[model samples]
Target: MPQVQRVPMRAVKNVVLIAHDSRKQDLLDWVKYNRPVLREHRLFATGTTGALVQAQTDLPVTRFKSGPLGGDQQVGAKIAEGELDVLVFFWDPLEPQPHDPDVKALLRIAVLYNIPTACNRATADFLVASSLFHGEYERIVEDHAAKRQAWLAGQGRR
Candidate 1:
């Protein structure tokens, strides 16, 4: 039997922020209101949103390139590397994104890594208010395994 290596994701929290051009103002407002909670951990963002947040909040943010210009992929890579924990992306449903696949993959990686994510204000409230910043993020490796097993079982049933 081959040995399986488990890479422990660090306890550090990394929150990602993204919003469409239409939702930029909304994102800024959310950041302003939640600056105290948000400052407890590291922050990552794509270009314009990062610029906006940094200018207003004085929050130290690490910025990737523009999302359409491969920033989403960069964040996904960090997730894959077990470097990121939480994602607070405010995506606009009304707009069609040219980088939809990249965005979708980033979301999928978050799920795969058991990273917490919030796409809207309601979920964002739950995430930012939770004790995840002060302690460890709840990661369910068994959930991933169970879901895969269930999928295989259902396939056989079909």
Candidate 2:
């Protein structure tokens, strides 16, 4: 039932980047301004967004396929598997997305996993400014042994 593995000092913070056509610029601006903070983490982005980020910022980016081509789900899978640390998805509210299901799934999974997520410029700013960005993160793994020992002791004669 536990979500993430309590990794207190990690070398890389797996961050996923996504942006609708209209919001691509927003993503770029944020990355441009916060490249220092972002550079310390490993970045993953979808298609053109990745190319753009790489071209504009100093951050290293691992690019997945385009969102419409399943990249969104790829990132979501990472979140579900606890491989992702944060998700900064700049979505265009006014325009309709072709990959609606993928977008919905990504949002749903992020919420389900209790991962830090930002859907717009303002939220992204807040997320980037959080002390957690520079501070250590504690990964909480399932304490299986502790639970089992406690159970055994509870049922013992002593």
lDDT of all predictions: 0.81, 0.83
Instruction: Give the per-residue lDDT of model 2 (tens digit) for 52-150.
Output: 999887567899999999899989888777788889999987888888978999899887667788999889889878777666677455555566777
TM-score for candidate 1, please give it: 0.81
TM-score of each: 0.81, 0.80
lDDT tens digits, residue span 54-129, model 1:
9999999999888999999998998777677778889988899999998889888888776778898888888777
Candidate 1 clash total?
Answer: 0
Show the lowest summed lDDT stretch of 10 residues, model 1.
1-10
Q: Give candidate 1's error at residue 17 in angstroms.
A: 1.3
What value of lDDT does candidate 1 attain over all alpha carbons?
A: 0.81
| Over 4 Å off, model 2 | 1-11, 139-158
- Model 2 alpha-carbon miss at residue 26, Å: 1.1
